[model samples]
Target: MPRVSTDQLAARRQQILDGARACFARYGYEGATVRRLEQTTGLSRGAIFHHYRDKDALFLALAEQDAGRMADVVAEQGLVQVMRDLLAHPPATDPASADESSWLGTRLEISRRLRTEPEFRQRWSSHSAELTRATRERLERQRRAGTLRDDVPVAVLAQYLELVLEGLVSHLAMGLPADDLEPVLDLVEAGVRRR
Candidate 1:
């Protein structure tokens, strides 16, 4: 009956996204049922669905938020900084830190869904493209500035960086020791730097 202001609508949408992220992280995509989402968000199914058409849409929105954050990092600081950030605050195994590491959970879920769900894979392509585009644009800038190697094409370099990022995510997701990663990352940077 009453009109909600733009700020209120945005705030409510954010509330749903934040709560849905935690719910999906704590319990994988399949596990985050409507009831769990309701409990986690402290909002009714009607409210949550009002923001998102369904669980899949909610998950996609959450993933998009993470992807956008990553793309920003890639654009401004380079993909390696994204890795550094993840290492600085590695995925949390303990419940206390789980909220902080929700992004990792979303990433892990994305990987799983991409492999098993064709429809989700199709839906996710555009988001993945943004990251690739950011990586290429960063590489192009470095190339113009004489920082990146000239022999390899920017496309190749972007793919290399994307692969490296994926590997780093897998390593971190598996709970591998990240203490020795600084030098490893240095090696990655060196691989693309001008000789």
Candidate 2:
């Protein structure tokens, strides 16, 4: 083939990451091997190794990217702002796949890996804690603003919200027919209101 451009190289790398994401999602971190990644991407072993040092490197890269995205989504803004924005519009970011169940399958697989694999556990836990901290800060602001109730501790609620969001991700990934989450939002709005 003709020589590729920088853009081409970047795209190729993303393509490999995308392929690796799917592969890693299907197979656990330990179960997902470089050879399997090679076959999945249809790239030679050298090509795969050239892009990634090894399976741990590849898994870490994927985890970092995904965890960062999750954090961004969680602590995106103060709880009030996020709720207002979400209520104002449906989620702009749809799952990558049209098939709903497949989205959950991949996420569930990754979650499994995060729990079972020590390597994944450390990265995921760290990122999750970061998200909780950021969210707690935002929630504290909301509480001070008189928007959030005092019944629940900000830190506890932040962690609770994270868990709820994880479920939301699973629900959205599953691609159930009713994509609207207004009802869920309504419940949350009610629960957080000052008594």
Candidate 3:
């Protein structure tokens, strides 16, 4: 067979990811089977296996994408604005796509998996650390600008925000509406901001 170009390979990979995203959105993480992914992607089971070792790995890839997107937004807008934007307008997993299926429900399953799955936990920790580092940098800037209060340690505050964000994911998994988190976040911001 002739060699496939880099662009073709990337497009095919993305198509698979999109298909997986839609399948997961329509069916919960536990509910979305490899057979379901095959149907969604229009690829045979063997083909899907060629790309991912198994279901868990595929799910992790999707979760990694979500984490990266969030980290990018946080790094770009700063944690405060990201929280405010999240409060102002609810967003689906992939905002650009018109699909209503969301990854919010999937996080709960991952959170449960994290307890027993050491590899999964390690992957999650790395992603969480990246966000934490970005948030910590932003916090340092805020501290120097006199926006963050002096009472709380910057490291503690950054970790607190990270934990709060993780809790929000868990809540979303539990069917908590994103909007309901607004007041909770408001309280957190108030607690952290200088009076």
- Top lDDT model: 1
Best by TM-score: 1
RMSD of 2: 5.9
Model 3 RMSD in angstroms: 4.1
- List where candidate 1 sits over 4 angstroms from the true fold: 95-97
Candidate 1 colliding pairs, count? 0
Worst 10 residues of 2 by lDDT: 95-104
Tens digits of per-residue lDDT for model 1 on 59-154? 999999999999999999999888888788777676334663446778889999999999999999999999999999999999999999999999
lDDT string, candidate 3, 155-189, tens digits: 99987887876766555445457766667777988
In the range 25-51, model 2's lDDT, one tens digit per residue, is: 556456567787887777877887787
1 or 3: which has the higher lDDT?
A: 1
lDDT of 3 at 158: 85
Give the winner by lDDT: 2 or 3: 3
